[model samples]
Target: MNILKSFFCAGLMSSTMAATSMVSGSAIAAEVKLRLLETTDIHVHLADYDYYRDKQSDKVGLAKVSSLLKTARSEAKNSMLFDNGDLIQGNPLGDYIAKEKGLKDGEVHPVYKAMNMLNYDAANIGNHEFNYGLDFLKKSIKGANFPYVLSNVYVLDGDKDPSNDKPLYDPYIIINKDVIAEDGSKHMVKVGVIGFTPPQIMQWDKANLEGKLRVEDIIDSANKYVPQMKEKGADIIVAIPHSSVSTSERKGMEENASAYLSKVEGIDAILFGHGHLVFPSKKYEGFPGADVAKGTLNGVPATMPGFWGSHLGVIDLTLSGETGNWKVSDGTGSVRGIYKRDGRKTIPLVEADAAINEAIKHEHEETIAYMRKGVGKTTAPINSYFALVADDPSIQIVTNAQKWYVQKLVNGSEYDGLPVLSAGAPFKAGGRGGPDYFTVVPAGEIALKNVADLYIYPNTLRVVKMTGSEVREWLEMSAGQFNQIKPGMDGEQALINTDFPSYNFDVIDGVTYKIDVSKPARYSKKGEKVSDGHRIVDMMFDGKPVDPKQEFVIATNNYRASGGGNFPGLKGDNIIISAPDENRTILANYIFDQKTINPSADKNWSFAPLSGKAKVSFTSSPSAKDVATSMGFETMGMAENGFAKYRIDLSK
Candidate 1:
């Protein structure tokens, strides 16, 4: 207990304290150096360019971070680089390869090609890896020269048998590495790597994963596998957890599992991913057992490299004694930033690695060629600066595309001639992604890059049957995006709840509604109903009051159809058409089918009446100048953390 606190405090002050302690240590004390290199959620970022904008960006790319990795490795004698997963399926490059240029038999994925060049020691699979289906994933995995480690996911044995199912990949891998102890004595070390991703994959990507695979909870997988690795003569065990640190402790079967996984007995350290966030910083200041400045939780060292290769995660551990009897005496976790987003400006640290840039040069050029192709022309500008405050055109185009595709699929079926509805969420709204994150396509020719910007992910299309009341409940959940405003209150109130993910704020296109922010939210993100205050009010459909039993076919994505956001009244059984097409393709094809696209939000959603001045403040992009007041926002000017402040007036 004393040792844990001592190391925690030592790491709190960082290197200076550790250096001071080392000098005062006994003369016989032995010390050795080891570094753990991690790359998580790379998401096919091969170059420092934004495919959506069709321009070079200093903020992202694996090639840029690969340069940092080489420098980091050069400083350490005993080091191993491991990718923690989510390497595929994020931007336009991943989409073009998935939908346009299909990977042929034995062809290596561009992500793996670059990763292989980096010589990753081991890796695991993240939820996004299944976006292209099991076959594509298998072929991509085959391209990696390093060992693939995954502990939880399993494949069914037979059509009628699941009890005897086996793991889809190896549960763990032990790598033999060289280490130099005190007195310059060299010894061999066995390092075991175990990995776990979100068990909710069975729900998020059900169409491709159901009836064929099963997943175990992350904590369960760690308890079952860590002991086995320990028994296999591993001197040190490193856990590659493709999950975020949960907000709470010992919360059973949650999506973010790093916090709980650290409590497991045999685990030495944790490498985090899947949240697309940076840790060991001020972001997790008061989190349980998490020392942000020290980069640890429960005395166990953990690190999560920022997503899209924006930052490289580096952990340094000082080992003592011989390699076979090595013990981690001191540890610290930190991130190397490639581009620091100071307000609106970004500061780049380094350029792309020459080797990686040259290796994937062909694919990089092809991806640009694909993104630059003109799809159609737009009469009006499309941007997400005011998406949350008002019904938005960026989302309108998506809903229109989904409704068009779903109507075609059910032309002669039982759902034919049924009232079709679609749900679209603003993907590029300003939040954790910063001010420049919002999509801005000017009034001109629309290209594949514009389409990619409108819809950021590669989620598949799905049509779900829902009742009117259920639809209202869905709107109520979406209303969680706003904060409660009291009537007659004088001071300015926060309008948007930053904790709510922008992708889950689905707005129904065919319906007109008002969100009463004075009421408390009906349910939390975990589907737990905490209060009964109704936020959704005046919900009407087809110019008439909607009935509780009225049915409608709603077009959405696979993630929402199978309950990714825990919205009320949603289940897989309600899905009507699970179309095997990417939403990005549907959007692009829809725009191309119509020579000109002129989409404008129909004012379907609004804030309900309040007694006092209907004033609330929100943050958006500083570039929303010409369209700010036109979209119903009173621009306040640029705020902190790369966001522009704005005020919304419901009385306007």
Candidate 2:
């Protein structure tokens, strides 16, 4: 029987016995006391507010989690508090400290300052730690109070010399904690903690970490080192992985370190992150026992808390003492949210530590002042609301800006006369992320910092040369953004896959063409062409089909140019020119060139046909209600799932 069922049955039997002995009231059963505490994917949200927008965000911030930690710790005698990586980056405070109040060599970062106040026992590194570079990472580590472990990432030792410049971190750490055994005897069990960062960092953050470090596959590293940890007197093994389990086959192919690592031997528990998902509660396809509530990883407890300090994961472990070693008998894991009041929309429950808050208070103020300083002006509102539906004003402005910048730089050159198609994705369309996440820029003075908020990614502009055929294939791959069209369907079928990652669906504004949902997609998510011909049927240049031999100049971010998504013909060799400036800068320059710019939805991009009405769900903040309704959908009443849902008519 399952743990909950067993507990229920025991209760029922006890009640029955009590009823039989009703003539004499019997003693009630004692409750088993065991507690665990955890915090995952804090992402350096130390304060209770969103420093970027200078507004309060109830969903995130370590200040809120601090209250949850204190209360949970108070509930148990033997409780272990842990953090599951991504502790660095995300907020303006982290950026300000790293870029502005530059780290003194060998000095601790402010994140470490706040983390130290929490007294975290162990922590794992997330991929974002490598975003700045290796030197910056090493300096940040110097400030950490706890050990950072990684089993997969290794520094390549030149000439295989042990004394030579070697890797920065140890593979795993064994933590010995005293606990009462099943027999009620006090004992010490050495819990082995191993950490792994996704190997895809070589591609994702190629600029910073490439050649300096080497990352082996997570499963390979786990199989290699887990036995060693066990041999070295570790009673239990826990994996702190900065990766998520794959939900769709499309997402599965994109490096999920946890799915493979969980199946490895000797691993007792797996603490996962990186795709920024909540787990044990939400199951993904291909993840073993993922559907099982509070499931065990290889018979050991496994969990992943939601990202950005919104939730804390706890695992209460029970162990048995045997000779010199200990083994896990059973355990339960749960995810808890941080809130001040019991009701929904309760203000952040926890208060920031006075010392930690004071430490970075000046840095915070300086960042605010810097962000408020205006760099330029915008005559119109630059919002990301309708970005996904059509040629969004925000994206259109960015594209126009990039095209203008490119045209000026290559004036009178051979590439200058070529027609340019600018591609941009909506960076801030609220989903999973709460209401405050949407990018809503007021019409007025525009600052460089605000530009950063507009384009959160550091992607640069690059021009790719592709034929008409390649362009159609590109759109077909993007068409995967919507659900597959069923047989004999009509009307506005729920447009593409809502979770297909807005970045992958390249919306080209300059060129106009109608998407035929009647046809099948030409390519798979990995860029493999499907057997069915092509879905992008009507490719036009000037009211006529594009010449198959003619080459078009496509402007896009460096990530897409370097084949970030498996889009065809956009990879390495197709590049015609690479701009040194970031896409956001190009966009800013474009807006400056065109004093008054107006962009609207082209209605060229739509999904395949639909059959019967199906409920399509996605996370959105309250602010997105108008935008969603404009796209033609029945807005479902709001639920407390941290996001709103809507029903779209699919039956034609």
Candidate 3:
């Protein structure tokens, strides 16, 4: 107790008081409402500009959210701001700062420079923070003016007891601060903040964090620390679990275990992210133990702000009773967005904080110039607006690049004679990311930005060896992106399942198959087998039925090869070559080498004709109308949130 007290007393300062001490015997007359503001999954969007499209966007960026911060803080009597994580690596600007111009000693990272200006109280370390490796992560966080707390992840020091293992960062921190009650009386309070990242980081970033670090389950870590914090004189405990909310039986180390974490004792408030969905919304209305109306999980106040700075989460707690016996009497949670849409018009709810944009102006300009450098020319237009509904040229070009690069590396190796296949998915098909998020590159000169738009993630190349039967299972898993359609039904059925992310809909280029949506999905969203339904029909390789026993090489990214998206039959052991170069870089190189390339879909895959009167419809960008018409589809008119609805007559 003395050691913990000494550490907090050494460097802690209250938000309102110059010098404050832990309240041992202070009395308060009335209740105090403390506002807890959170921004999660910022993903280094410091500016309100899209680096891929190279245009101004009013929908995203922390600069826009920063304006909401000032308003939110001004409305509350007492408040604290914290970021739930995913702060360092999402957009091209972040890539420029980390890869092009590296962070050095005495240099502040651009994201941190902007965040520091907002006066953040503290932050959590999200799972994406480990994508660039440990040294880079360490260097990036050093520039932050505020502290970081991560309770679950730790260094492997070969200790007999896990509790004694050294944490990669502070497990928790107790901030002693003075607060003003409604009666205008001042009282000191101890607020303990603890954070947890998903345990799957071990699998997601295995190459960078294999033997160096280990992560524990979120509930276990919270159980271990919350009691200790209370014993160490913490009046209120706030948990920032960077995982999402799930209402499932606690099986340990499960991703999206925030609901289970809420059942932990002594936690007053919860702020979670990583699912990139808003809390208290209709999305989780029937989820067990989750009160969508009250914005809580297991009756504890909680919220998850949308990703990429689209929204801000706020939790207000009414604290009552005396200083030593203070408790939360009432609690509420809500989210505020930076923009809203009415029909086709997007209305900006807040302006970008000019200070934040100014802080990173030089880096932002460099990133724009870096992306605008010409790489090659494209003979046909490329866009992802129709990628999910049909075979798309945008995805075809990426798979071609992957197969081209992988063939060169395995020419004389042990896997030379095996058939090579490439897997690619539409990353920007615009579900939760909004209508303008899809890729669109015109038929003309191509630049580095075009390649980046084609393949958004920073995943490195990896080749996995699998049998022909295993490939079938892989396709079946990817087929979960579609919902089962009934035959001979009336009215319209949704063609695309919004719950399944478009990035996980991997299409293998070397095989030809048709998706039968009338059949039920064989795998669940978590990649577990739920039924024996077969969706992939006429599975052919080399103009014949694929042999189940034949072996083949699959060119893919590290995330898929290492069990990301929970795909079937992947656990990192089957990888034949783990290339360190990013897929986007390989794509850029492939385009440059060709000088002039034709991006045309080979029509390798399509949906099997459905015999029914029911119309199949899907929503996409309003700009996709011309392409949809060219493919013999008709626009069904506008859908909600500015998305244009289109119908596909499957009987054709």
Candidate 4:
């Protein structure tokens, strides 16, 4: 007989309702309820404020989620709170603490000050946790009141096998807790918790972890240690993989491996994230081995809350049987949002936790003042509203800054005299972040916050050398951001593929090309060749066609140069220059040196004309009308979810 008990499947319900029904009026059946609460991918939005826009926001903040945490804990007699990582870095507050304020020997990070107040049981190591280097990460986490658990990261001792290596943190922790049973008797339940991070951290943060640390595969690490946790008197095991749930087949080292991790034996429940998406919602209704209604992946209950403290993931497990033979008989998983959206209005579901706000008050104010200091000036407004549709000034400025910085570094080196191109993407273009997420820097003094807004990530500058043929292949991979449209297709076709992340759509400067949306995409989002389509046409450099064998240097971020998005041909080996300065700081320096700058797109790229009068449409912020009309786009009135629809005639 299998020791793992089969879960009772049921429709989704509120955490309170599930807790009330499970524990109310029960016989002496030795039944117990264990409520697990999770917060993942917070990205350090400690307060209800948008640092990019420098204003109060109703959409994100941990201060607001704290109230929801209180209510969820109140509904259950036995509860444990766990953070799924990505807590130390995201917003300007995180940057302020990591780059400006600096963590002293015993000084606690502001985010930790707030998290310690909430009393997190344990936290998994997220990929972004290594963004500020290993030293900063170590000092920051030292202030946490709770222990951090990770099974994959290791420090090898002259062994090739990870099993022989020493772990950076404890692989798992078995917590012994006393809880009231359905029979009104006290029972000690030993709950085991284990964690796994994306193994690709080695590549993403190569500068930080290359020689010091090694990461094992997520599934392999789980298979290695889960049985040990079971043998050590753990009645139940909960897995917290800082990874997303994917329906893709497992081939090892996948960034999203929760679906594969769920198949590991002894994993009674799972809390997964890193995709910044919500599970148990309609978005994941049809994924393989997923029961959205029951909130289970392969019959194991799981939950992934939205990022930036927007939702609280709740997993309630009801175990029944004798003391030593207790098993999970029933469970339900769901996410509770801090706010709700009704058209353009935001309805707050919970108030900000006063205690959390008070804990981080000093740091929050300092971050604001630090972000407000002016760096330079911009003669024209820079916005990412039309970054995907056309060559916009927002991306143009970043590319220009990158090219300027790289040119100085590689001036007389072995890579000198090569044609330098730059790649930039819109990080703030709204999708899941809502309409207010786009960057809008008005024509005036450019502050440090505005520079941070343009480049949201803390990616360092890198230059990769590739042949012209390989560069085209790089652009081909970015072309996956668009959906294929048939000529003379009925109705308006969607122009952009919303499923494709805006960050992956790289716009290469110093080259001109046209994207033929009528043709099939040559590459998929995963860099797999699914079609033989050549969507890039009329590619030119210096008023002539680019030679296939010609060599060129491309300035980009470390993430892309190190195969962060799985782009073709370019990897860590080809990178010639890995500058220590961050791209945001370079941009700030470029702007400061210029004193006053003008940002205007060179119109290096556009959509190829269709044979017939085909029309395509995409949604953007309602405030983007002036920019759209100035570019001669036809407005299609208001769209759903407070977006303004615009149509483009491809036949033009």
Candidate 5:
């Protein structure tokens, strides 16, 4: 006998046996029971492991999620699984496919080959999907088993049918299924799922999408279509938006598509992604009739599972026959990992499907061979162990490479005399990213795969023209790296903001600067100047005060050039030159160009004088001990207190 609990806003009641017995006496007997399963932001880790580093990543990949999908289907009467995009262009495997295999017309892309095995009902386009040229995207989509949905992106062609000039995916897909009601009767549910990508893709990848296509605001597109979907006999509406809710200064406001689409009259549930965080459940007050926290949007249920195939979002709906609408009865969203790594042995919790695994086995094997192809040689072990506490050789090599690449370009151009500065941040600096995530290059043959591991993103090198004052403001934003200063002296504590994103703390290697956390920060991470006195003090170039009016050429990624870091005066008009080569590629070329390059930490950048200190603790995996100690910091004995603490003299 299977015992199931029936839930409603009123209360929960236990019932024995099948779902058909309870609804015999009701006036309206027919009811629909539909289950929606969603997977979002699976960044191309299809084989269940990170092939670039030759290890298993517990946080991402589809191997772990396969188990959750199996378990979810076993519990549901009628189910449909949908992927919410970002499937292409993230890991080293994605790079291997794009750069090596080269997707030509009629050829199947590796990501699509992996995704086709999953049998997704429908998928949305993510901003990262357009990172490669539009031609590549067109070829990849041709081989997909499912129809790609996009309501916002439009093709521009004169008078002719847009579909004729350019292939456009359908805006929405309506899936019809027979759902078993509690009373043993079957009801048909028309699930209309609409997909939207953020309109900001134009700004992020203007080179690929600007003149060829146009993206409208998310809200405007959803509003125009909700009525149409409803008119088309869609009983339940789900908006699969590849946009994230804002978590900045405004806490609960729905800044993205999920929040904005939930307010639309016909939307019943919202499946969200792109921010890469989990929102199991949330409530938006401004939207009427939608109570998302209770699993209901406008009285409908909504959920966003975490990214990287870590979790499968399950939303269960209880339909009302009298009103002809669905409401969230009860729901739960959770993360599922494939294997549990205790020590040397990894315990397998989920097994990969034989068919799916076997289908891509050849491609998987070839990808490994492609990544291991050697690029150059490294004289010393390059790692990011001390990246957070002090200057690190791993990041230094990247910045050094950027400076080398830009100096040649500047010398060839009219701006040869301008001072060139390299700005780079440590991506894997052992904070939220676990211990093994840190970049550790052995002193030997450095492969292209290893180079990719050091710089994970496919960001292009861009030169931005910034004044010394704007550069000062940019450094001030990075000053958020330190803990708040205390009033009186006399304290011994750690002096770091463990929660600060390591990527935002720009280490400008060519210039010398001291961050005075003793003074308030002049600018917030969002580029807002909160305090009058600048946190960056005594900024010097070649031991001389930097001229406020002097122009400088700064090397950074395309993301920063398009204002990804919220840095002041680094967006739009400030861009001087956009290099076609990726930043990591430039770094690789620089290493090869140098033949034998030695990267050393300058130690030019440091925190301001500490007035008072407080003991702050942080947690790191055991693997970071050796790297941490090499940077001149003492790691206290391990604490069963759930976090690791390192003692540092805050006083300058």
Candidate 6:
């Protein structure tokens, strides 16, 4: 039996209510059950195996999710499958396909291969799809039989934002699927599927998108196309937006705008992503019109399938229609988890689907071989266990590469001779990825797999001009990683704020500062001024107090430079150079050029000295036990969940 649970709030109608809504006899319109299945942020996991670890992992893979798809489809009479973007690039396999295997003019990427074999009805373009440039994206999707809808982006008429004059892709697809009613009679159901991706793609992918395209705001595009879908005789409209409901404001051109998108007049349901979070979760509590218990926003049913094929987003709509038209009577949303993550262990629900594994068999084999090749050697062990506690090498190498690349890229340009800074973050630190997820590359010859472990995302390098004050705000946002604590009253206060993602804890190189955790955060992750105290103190550049007006070039990934984490004063307009190189490739080149890369992290930032004795605790991999003290932390022995708890004596 499917472990299906309803996320309906009290007084909200459910499947039980749908059964009671039908009229008594022939006076009843036809009641059709439509199952809309969505897979999002798959990130090129076509199989159940981790190409880097060379082991089977239950936590990912579309093949394992394919089993869930078949089961989900079997439970309903009429079903439609969709991919909510971010499918083309993410893992070592995706990197291998892009760097080694290479895409020919008409060849299909393995991601599209698996997506096509799964019979995706329609898919949207994800921001990462633009990582390899437009030609690559255009060529990669050639093998897909289904249409890829992108409502917001447009072909530029003369170098401006998306206009009504031209759309880059098909705005929507009206699928004329034959529906079978409870009476065993079949009728045509005009189901409209419209897709919206982040309009910030124009900024995040400025290198590839500048002169070629302009992406309109998602809410604006939805307001325009949703009505068109209705006028085109669509019975039901399902929006597959590669965006999420992440911000506090329910309106704006915010990266995650699914909540407002759902409020549009004609949209019946929405699938949101790119934040890699599970919706209908407790994280969305207190938002007006957002019923976490009901998996809805503004009364429109929605769901976000977890990333890496972890779960399948399912929305069931009970439609009762007249001979020529249909209206949604009852609707509900739920997600099916293919694996159960318990601490360090994962339990798979089903085996990998045979057809999907067979579909990308060759690419998988090649990717494995590519990841194992030695890139260069490291002078010392590189691990991220101490990332939050101290400056870490895993982040240092990436920043060093960015700084190196950007310094050279801006050498002869109009912004020459300006001091360069780089923002670095621990990507593989133990957070949502679990304790064992921290990067641990032993001192030796580093392989492509280790490089992937060091830098996980496929973000490209960028250089943005930032004022000293804006730079302080950037560090202030990164300093939000800590939990506020009084000097003498703490007992086992968590060192890191669990809610703040490790990815956004950026350490700004080429400067020095102190984070005073006793003070409330200057700004929350949502850019809200929840408190007024500034945690970033003694922020300096070049041995002098940072001048608020002084301009400095900071090398950063496209995500941060394009206001990805919502950092202040950072956006496309400030960008001076948008390199077409991925950070991983830049790191590989830097290592290869140096031959013996030293894993050294500059102690640029540290916690402020407290007035009295205070203590805090954090969890790290058990492997960090032997080296905990040398890193200035006292191990409190292993916890029951297999993590090593360490205590920080702030008095030191």
* lDDT of candidate 2 over 1-652, digit per residue (tens): 6999999999998667645434332222212234556677777787766655767667677767777788888877666666777776766666667666779987778788777888877888887787667888888888988888887776767666534645458889888766543323344557788888877677666656656777777777788889999999987888888887754333322467576666687887777877666666644433554544655554567677788888777777765544245566677667777653332255655665456667657666777776676656776666775455445666766777776776676678777767777777777776456545677777777765667677776566788877777777777777665555554443334544655677677777566665554456666665787757666666677667877777778888777877777787766678788777767667656655665455444544554334555344444555667767766756766645345555554345
What is the Cα-based lDDT of residue 295 in candidate 2? 52
- Candidate 5, RMSD to the unseen true structure: 6.2
**C-alpha lDDT (0 to 100) for residue 336 of candidate 3:** 93
Instruction: Supply candidate 4's per-residue lDDT for 142.
Output: 93
Give candidate 3 misplaced runs (Cα > 4 Å).
1-25, 158-164
**Model 1 over residues 434-505: C-alpha lDDT tens digits?**
788889899999998899999888888988998999999898888888878877778888988887888889
Look at candidate 5 and tell me the lDDT of residue 41. Answer: 82
* lDDT of candidates 1 onward, in order: 0.85, 0.68, 0.89, 0.90, 0.71, 0.82
Question: What's model 3's overall lDDT?
Answer: 0.89
What's the candidate order when arranged by decreasing TM-score? 3, 4, 1, 6, 5, 2
Q: How should the candidates be ordered by lDDT, best one leading?
A: 4, 3, 1, 6, 5, 2
Per-residue lDDT for 271 in model 6? 81
Candidate 3, residues 1-652: lDDT per residue as tens digits? 9999887776453322322322333453458889999999999888999888898889889999999989999998899999999988988887877878888888989999899998888899999999899999999999999999999999988765665679999999998767777755667678999999999999889889988898999999999999999999998999999999765577899888888888899999999999999997888889988888888888899999999999999999999886777788889889999999988888999999998999999998999999999999999999999899899999999999999999999999999989999999999998988888899999999998889899888899999999998998999988988888886888888989898989999999999999998899889878889998789889899999999999999999988999998899888999989998999999999999999889999888988888866468999999999999999888989998789999987764
Query: Which candidate ranks first by lDDT, i.e. highest?
Result: 4
lDDT of 5 by residue, 1-652 (tens): 1233324422332233232333433234445566778888877777676765776555566756766787888887778778888887888777777777777777777677767766677888888888887777777789898878888888877565655443256788787756677656555667788888877777677667767887777777788777898888787787888987643432231225565566678777677888666554332344444454555544446666766676677777666663245443444333344544455334667666555556667777888887787778888888776676577788889999999999989996978899999999888766533445678788888887778878888889999888888888888888777666663545543456764678888888788888776677677665777888877888999899989988899998887778776677866678888899999999889877777767677887876555545333344545666765765556775533223556545454
lDDT tens digits by residue: candidate 4, 363-415: 99999999999999999999999899899899999999999999998899998
Rate residue 387 of model 6 by lDDT.
Answer: 93
Residue pair clashes in candidate 4:
none
Candidate 2: misplaced stretches above 4 Å?
1-37, 158-166, 179-186, 247-254, 282-287, 339-356, 412-417, 486-493, 524-531, 542-544, 570-580, 588-652
> Please, what are the lDDT tens digits per residue for candidate 6 over residues 486-594?
7888467887888888888999899989888888888888666677678999988888899999989998888888777778787677888878888888998888888
Clashes of each: 0, 6, 0, 0, 11, 1
TM-score of each: 0.93, 0.83, 0.95, 0.95, 0.86, 0.88
**What 10-residue stretch in candidate 4 is worst by lDDT?**
3-12
> Could you tell which candidate, 2 or 4, scores higher by lDDT?
4
Error of 6 at 3 (Å): 43
Question: Could you tell me how far off, in angstroms, the CA of residue 591 lies in candidate 1 after the best superposition?
Answer: 1.4
433 in model 3: Cα distance from truth in Å? 0.6
